[model samples]
Target: MLQASDITYTYNGGLKLVFPNISCPTGQHWLLLGQSGSGKTTLLHLLAGLRTPTTGSVSIGGTDISKLRASRLDKFRGKNIGIVFQEPHFMRALNVEENLALTQSLSGQKVDKKKIHTLLDRLNIAHKLKSDTSALSQGEKQRVAIARALINDPVLILADEPTSALDDKNTREVISLLEEQATAAGATLLVVTHDNRLREQFPNQITL
Candidate 1:
């Protein structure tokens, strides 16, 4: 459901990063492996429609997002491309459910409290629904982040360094949750990270 081809980016200093082509089918999980400074983040941003590649195209369901105008791109991304950042960013004043409600609202989607609650329940963070984000444990907060990402039922899920700080067990758990949720939503999942241990977890991978 996701395809990125001949991707390249160039900075003002003339530094250029070229990425390997990636094609992930519907409901599949893929690990994008690379070391530090390997442009993994850059490629992730491109795939998420957050950054326009200097060359090539990124498509989901045959829609070449590189050609989308800014407004259209933002709208399309919010509706179809869900991103999980390495660190959780929350509105301190808002409770867990409130935060997720805001995500749906920002996406131009109706606030579906039932959907938000169901997602948190699945991620085991439903107990924190009314708790301030600051009051939650780091792990709980991370799970909330996952819940927010899946709330939109995006067509493609792009997770950047989702497991960089976790231990082996948590890493495995988080990866499984991502895959399970993606499958449930009928979305393609692509995790971009520098972690080598993931090489053993995903059957399909492309290294930068």
Candidate 2:
């Protein structure tokens, strides 16, 4: 569902970061493994169209996203891609449900309360719907972020260091939640992290 051809990026005044070619098929789950400063997160951002590449192309579901106009890219990304960041950034004043509702509105998609409730339930955060985001624990907040990512029913899911702050159990739970939901929705999942503990869980790996 996603392909990156001859991708290259440079920073720190012409220092090249790893930008080898990469590709993944539909329904595949990929783990991008690399240590600090290895360009794992950079590659993830490029694939998600959050960062434009200096050269080469990133195509998602057959469209060359790197070539899209800024306005068109925003709309296409909202509908085709979902991202879970290392830190779950939510509106401090909004409740869980409200935060998710706002996400739907921002994406220009109709709100589906049932789908929202079902995703929260799947992530074991259904009871926290009425709770303010500021009152939740880190793990709880992560679950909420996952729910928000799934709310749009995106075709490609990209997660960056999602398990960084979680304990072993929570890490497993978070990975399981992402894997299960992505597979059920027929969305491609790409998780970028330095966590080797996850290797046993996902056999496929793309090391940078």
Candidate 3:
């Protein structure tokens, strides 16, 4: 479902961050592991098309996203890719459901209330649908973040350092939730992190 080849990135007046080619098929779960400076985040950003690679191409479902124009790429990402960052971000003024509705609308999708409710229900956060984001506990917040990422039923889900802030129990729960949701949605799940504890749990792994 996703592929990257010959990837390299460079910051202004700095060294290049090179990455190995990555390929993941549909409905598969993958772990991307690397040390702190190993370009894992850079690689994830390139795969998500958040940063255009200095070299090589990223392909999703056979489309070469590297060749797409910025506007088109943004739309394409909105419709096809879902990302979970290390720190979950939400509009403080918006309630949980409103934030989800806003995300769908930003992607040019009309609000799918049924979809939103179903996603939150699956994440066990249906009760928080009308609550302010600041009111959620950490685990609840993470679950909500996962819900937001999956709100669009994206074909590919990319998570960066998702387990970094959690305890072993929460870490396991989050990872399990991500895998389950990806399977349920028929989307590819790729998590990039320095958390070695995840190594034993995932069967498919790539190191940078």
Candidate 4:
């Protein structure tokens, strides 16, 4: 469902990072492994179309994202990709459900309350629906982010250091949740992290 061919990126004016060609089929799970500064997150951002690569192409479901206009790219990303970042970011003023509702609204899709509830229930955070984001604990907030990412039922799921803050139990729980949802939706899953503990969980790994 996603492909990155001969991708190269540079930052800080001179530093360059090159990645091997990577492709992910629907219902497949991939782990991007690298240390800090090794460009794992950069690769995830490139695949998500959040940042364009300096060279090469990224395509999702057969369309070349690099050639898309900025407006069209944004719309395409909203419809096709879901990303969970290392840090959970939310509108502090909004409750958890409101935050998700706003995301669906912006995506030009109606909110699917049943799906939202099911996602939260699966992540064990259904009770936080009425709570303000500020009141959630770190783990609860992360689960909320996962719920938001899955709310769109995106075709591709990209997670950057999603297990960074969790203990072993929570890490396993979150990983399992991501894999389960992605498989159910027939979505391609790519998780970027330095955590080798995840290796046993995801056998299809790309080491940078």
Candidate 5:
């Protein structure tokens, strides 16, 4: 479960963003919709512990991540939170398998090759395991991103602008894939997107 309350972030030059309180329970899927400059990505970063809010706390599974030291926060986020950025930034020198393996190692977990393969298989990206990430098509890369995000069996999955560049068919497929994988992992899912096409897809939604 995830809880964020009294969230306000201020950037330099006096830009301020105040986010609504969020309380998402385990296994639920929620969508966060906002227009450009609405701080959707900023809010996602706060919830994912990638950034600290200026005025609030974010709790995942009862731990106040904002209070964690950097080292501990890094390890905890790696293990408990899976983030799918709009751009999948894989290390250029690493193949899909190596990239995913690095994620496991970074989380202080043993590299589970079986887990890697199974996740790739489920995402239909098994054929790309040894392939360089740059060689993948857009959809393939997105699937691989999903595979990487699920490789650690994170308790919460945060996807930012996941379907912004996709057509209707691929958008639906990606959303379905995320939902299916999250359900299987027993993880709460939060998607931050500006796309109006997804408005009707999630009944539990927050619009900024």
Candidate 6:
């Protein structure tokens, strides 16, 4: 489960963005909607533990991540929080399999080839295991990103504008895939997007 309260952030330029509290229980799915400059991404970062909120508490699975030391927070995030960014970033030189393996290594886990293969197979990208990440099509890369996020069986999955660029059909497909994967992992899924088409897809929604 994920819980956040009194969340607020201040940009270096003196801009302050306050966010609503979020309480998403385990295995639940929620959608967060807002416009382009509505701080959707900022809130996602705070919830993911990528950025510290100016004032507030963020707890995941009963651990107050906001107060954790930098080193411990890094480890905790690696094991429990999975984030799929609007743009997938990968080491250009690494193959698909190697990229996923790197995530495990960073999290202090030994590379699990079998798990990597199994996840890729489920995402329908097993054939691209040896392919360079840059060589995959946009859709394929997004699928790989999803696979990477699920590789460690994170308890919380936070996706930022995952389907913003896709057509209606692809949007539905990607949303379905995210929901299916999160359910399989028993993880709480929170998607932050400006896409209103998704409003109907997730009944529990918060608007900024």
lDDT of each: 0.90, 0.89, 0.93, 0.89, 0.93, 0.93
lDDT of 5 by residue, 33-62 (tens): 999999999999999998999998999999
Clashing pairs in 4: none
lDDT for model 1, please.
0.90
Q: Which stretches of candidate 6 lie over 4 Å from their true place?
A: none
1-208 in candidate 4: lDDT tens per residue? 7899999999978999999899888779999999998988889889988899999999999989999988889988888899999899999889998999888877889987777777788778899988999999988888899888888889999999999888999899889988988888888999999988899999898889
lDDT by residue for model 1 (85-113), tens: 89988998899999999989988999999
Clashing pairs in 6: none
**lDDT, candidate 2, 1-208, per-residue tens:** 7999988887759977757777888988989899988988889989989889888999999999999988889888888898999999899888999999888878888887787888898888999999999999999999899888888989999999999888999999999999998998899999999998899988778889
TM values, all candidates: 0.97, 0.96, 0.98, 0.95, 0.98, 0.98
Off by over 4 Å in 1: none
Error of 1 at 31 (Å): 0.5
lDDT of 4 at 161: 98
lDDT of 5 at 204: 95
* Cα lDDT tens digits for candidate 6, 30-149: 999999999999999999899999999999999999989898999999999888878887999899999999999898789999999999999998999999999998888899999989
Q: Give every collision pair in model 3.
A: none
Residue pairs in steric clash, candidate 1?
none
User: Which residue window of length 10 is worst by lDDT in model 2?
Assistant: 15-24
Clash count list over all predictions: 0, 0, 0, 0, 0, 0
